[model samples]
Target: MFGIYIHIPFCRKACHYCDFHFSTSLNYMDEMVDAICKEIALKADRVSGTAGSIYFGGGTPSILPATALQKIFQTLEKHFDIATGAEITLEANPDDLNAAALKTMRALPVNRFSIGVQSFFEEDLRWMNRAHHAGEAIDSIRRSQDAGFENLSIDLIYGYPLLSDEKWESNLATAISLQVPHLSSYSLTVEPRTALAAAIEKRKEPAPTDAQSAEQFRMLMARLQSARFEHYEISNFALPGQYAVHNTNYWRGVPYLGIGPSAHGFDGHTRYMNMASNATYMQALLRGQLAEERELLTDHDRYNEYVMTSLRTMWGLDPELVISRFGRSYHDYLHTALGKLGSNDWLISGDGKIKLTTEGKLYADHIASELFKVDEE
Candidate 1:
């Protein structure tokens, strides 16, 4: 089964930390939506049969007018066979999620809601320049739940200069109080050229530190696990049977089509990304072409990707699959590397699966890279 992701590259406000491709100007909104639809049609024939999930991710998917959302959905329906009861998700911000808007969203195929409630404190909200207030976050969540969209996930951010441990705990407490089924939390990072990065450089804002981030992350994991939430992925927690399907598909190497500017897609063998410019993307679609760059994966690239993605989850790498799928050479290499890594007590093995210990998870990317195959051919 395959999945679909449509990136809506428009937002009402620019968050300081965000580096995603988007425009705050609404001048090109109509043309942008039309271009997305045309691109959807242009790429529809390439999708594999049986779409298991559809995700409306963004710069703020909820910023689009209802008619625009419906038009894209209609386009998908005409071109692809979306599976019955597929997990359809929409990424929304709190300010845009009023009662009337939630009512309209329920009428569409969006079964899951991923609200961008980065923090529940007024100070944190202001620090990040998020579009919503603390009260708006809580109210929008309640309104969405009242509207009968129960499959919900909320995002929280920790490890910033202003987010004290007390505030982080309060954030998780708020999420729990709302009974949200899934939670996606991340440590605040300053991406290059973003406002946050510039502010830090100018001594306007304190930079994030590893020690504080690690401590808060540990608190987050412990609190959520005590509340019966599974730390299924490093940055994700979900109650039973409530994992984000589209994201999980990505982890398990399932194929997906990413629509809209700066979106990335993967078939079983190759990966591609659309151009990041709105004007360029729209012009290409208007001219009956896709401004995407493709990269064909070598076996080593695929193996390294598998190692990196799998190690980040609760389920670790499988030696048997490595041997069968990648070759005996990879199988032997995995064992040899495991021996070296085991000395550090970072990884634990049992029940025919290898997984990261609590300490190992902090450096998961480093561990995966250490086990990588760097040879060509």
Candidate 2:
């Protein structure tokens, strides 16, 4: 089934580690809402079938007003067929989930909350320049549960100097205790020109170490697995039946439509992304134009994308699918390149699927790129 993504590009504060396209300014919030609604109408025909999931992600989607969210939801209702049991997720921050806010949200169509609980510690929150405190992080989860949001996910971060092994352990323990259905964790990566990168250059913060990140990841796997959380995707852990439908569809290369500045869409053959500028996106949409760029995928592009995504998931990559879908040439290339991953010790073969061992996941990106297809001459 197809999915829909709406990017909200405004946040109350700019997190130090974020390089996502967002603005701290709310100067154009109303205009942006209008433009996004216009865009949903604009691209309705390009998408096919009922949406199984609709994800409102962002620069803090929870920061938007209840009225604004409702307006967007109303627009969606008028445009497409949304599945009755569709998974609707809103990426919310801790500070935004007070009682009144949660009350208003309950009335809205959103059924899931993906809380941005980067770390449930005071120092980590302050270091990352997050707007929430440790207490709010803890309280927010309980409060949301009281508000009846069971389809929940909280994001945690590892691999930063500020996050010690003990602190990382505390974070996982907190996540398990909360009993949130889903968890998405990632190692901190310093993006160029971001505050974290600048801080590292100026010796304000210690650079993230590969050793620290790897250790933390291993800790995460053991903790989550013992906690009975399925390591579904490399960075994602969930209780059984709680896998994120939207993202699972995305990983499986299902077609989706994205509307808003800095949003991306895939329609099987072509992938498109909107211009990142809020002003530019609004201006173009006001003029009845689609503000996006497109790339038509070649077989090489498609195969490489498949290998990269599939390998990162628990399902792994299928050699037979490569032979049938991408032809025998790609299948042969895959077997030949399996040597680059070193011994088959880290790779296990069962049911014709090449899945990575937990040890192999630390090098997943490198491994996937090693198996990438070069366009034939």
Candidate 3:
């Protein structure tokens, strides 16, 4: 199944830890939206199959005026063969969520809402430099539910320097208490060049420790599992069949088209990303050219990508698929790597598939790296 992702690269304020391409300025919103709609029209033929999912992700998708979102959705419907029952998700921040805005959203074709409620504590919110307060975070969900939007997901960040173990537990409890259907929890990592990194360097903010992050991750797993949430993915939990279909399709290596500044698209073989700069993107689109760069994937690259993504999911890596796709050498290499990790209880093999155990998940990246095939000089 194919998917479409629209990136809205504008936020009200920059979160200290965010390294994503977004501007706090809304001056270019109109022009950017028009350019994106045009880009969508231009690239519609590129994704001619029925779309299973349409995702509106960004700096803050909810920050856009409802008319802007409506126009884009209309354009998509006009050009693409979107499925009858597709999962259309909008990533929103709590501050932008109110009764009036949610009522407008409910009238649209959007079926899912992924709220960016990173924390439920005021101290943690302040630490993250988020725009919303603790109360707004809780109210946003309640407001959505009040407006008859139930297919909801909330994002949570654990392991922040200010988020104590008790506070982390409280955050999860708040989500569970709200009866949020899906939860996407992430451990805070200070990416290079972000404000968080600079702050840590200057001793303004405490740096995130690996031990704290790992403990919080463990806590996340335990709490969610006890609440009957399915650990469908490494960072995602759902109730029953409520997985984020857009993200799942992406991890499964399905073809998708991404539009807007800094958007990335994959069409099975080649991957392309739009220019990250808003001015450059707008200029090029106005000139009727998509400002993007493309790279063709080599066999080794594809295999390694498969290993990295599949190994992290609950559905593990299928050995037979590997053998059939990448030949005996790669398969044998994987088998050897699996054997090395066997003693550590990092992997469990049965049937034709091999997946990571909970303990193995802690070192998932390291394991994938060990299994990687570097290019020969």
Candidate 4:
């Protein structure tokens, strides 16, 4: 099944840890919406068949008005075949999900809300420069549930300087208490050029420690698993049958259309990346042209991507599928690589698939990099 991802590149506030392409200014909201709709119509023919999921991600999709969202959906309806029960998700901040907002959202086709409630503590929220307070975070989820939007997820962050082990446990406890079906938790990474990184460089704030992050991640896993949540993906936990459909499709290499500035689309063999500049995206789309670059994947590139994404999921990478898709040579290469891993507690083979041990997950990126298929010099 195909999917579609729309990047709404505007935010009410710039979170300190975010380096995503977005503007705090709403000066061109109408124009950007128009451009997005135009981009959808323009790229309609690229992917065939019904869309199983449509995800609105980025700077804060909920920051847009219901009318703007409706207009975009109308354009999508006119151009694409969306399935009867498609999962349409909007990534929202807690501040935007007020009573009036959720009421208006009920009229739209959006069925899921991925609320960005980074923490349920006022100090933590302030540190991250998050748009909402602890109360707003709690209220927004209740309001969304009250408004009949039960399929919800919330984001939580750990490993920052202010987050002690006690506070980290409290964060997880609060999320579990909220009864949200899905949770996407991440460690605070100080990306270069972001405010967090800048502060650390100047010694204004201490950097997040790997030891702290790993400890918190373990706490997260144990707590959530005991709460009956499945650790489906490394950073995602969900109650039974409540996985994020769009992101799942992404991991499975399903073809999807990416609309709006800075969005990326993939169709098995190639990728389309839109220009990140808002003005450039709008200008190009207004002239009926796409401001995007295309990359055709090589076999090595495809294999590496597959290994990286598939290994992150609870469904481990299949060696048989590797043999069938990439031939005996690549399969042999994999066996050799597995030999190199050699009795490490990081990986386990069961049911003809190779999966990571829970502790191994902390070194997932390292392990995946080790397993990568590289080009011969």
RMSD (Å) per prediction: 1.0, 0.9, 1.1, 0.7
True lDDT of residue 236, candidate 1: 95
User: In candidate 1, what are the lDDT values of residues 186-231, reduced to their tens digit?
Assistant: 9998999899999999999889999999999999989999999998
Clash totals, every prediction? 0, 0, 0, 0
Scored by Cα lDDT, where does model 1 land?
0.91
- 255, model 3: CA deviation in Å? 0.7
For model 2, state the Cα shift of residue 220 in Å. 0.2
Per-residue lDDT of model 4, residues 234-327, tens digit only: 9999999999999999988899999999999998899999999999999999999999999999889988998999899999899999988888
Q: Is candidate 1 or candidate 2 better by lDDT?
A: 2
Comparing 1 and 4 on lDDT, the stronger one: 4
Q: Tens digits of per-residue lDDT for model 2 on 72-134? A: 999999999999989999999999999999999999999999999999999999999999999
Candidate 1 off by > 4 Å: none
Give residue 64's error in model 3 in angstroms: 0.7
C-alpha local distance difference test of each model: 0.91, 0.94, 0.90, 0.94
Cα displacement (Å) at residue 294, model 1: 0.3
Per-prediction TM-score to the true structure, in the order listed = 0.98, 0.98, 0.98, 0.99
> Would you list the rank order by lDDT, best first?
4, 2, 1, 3
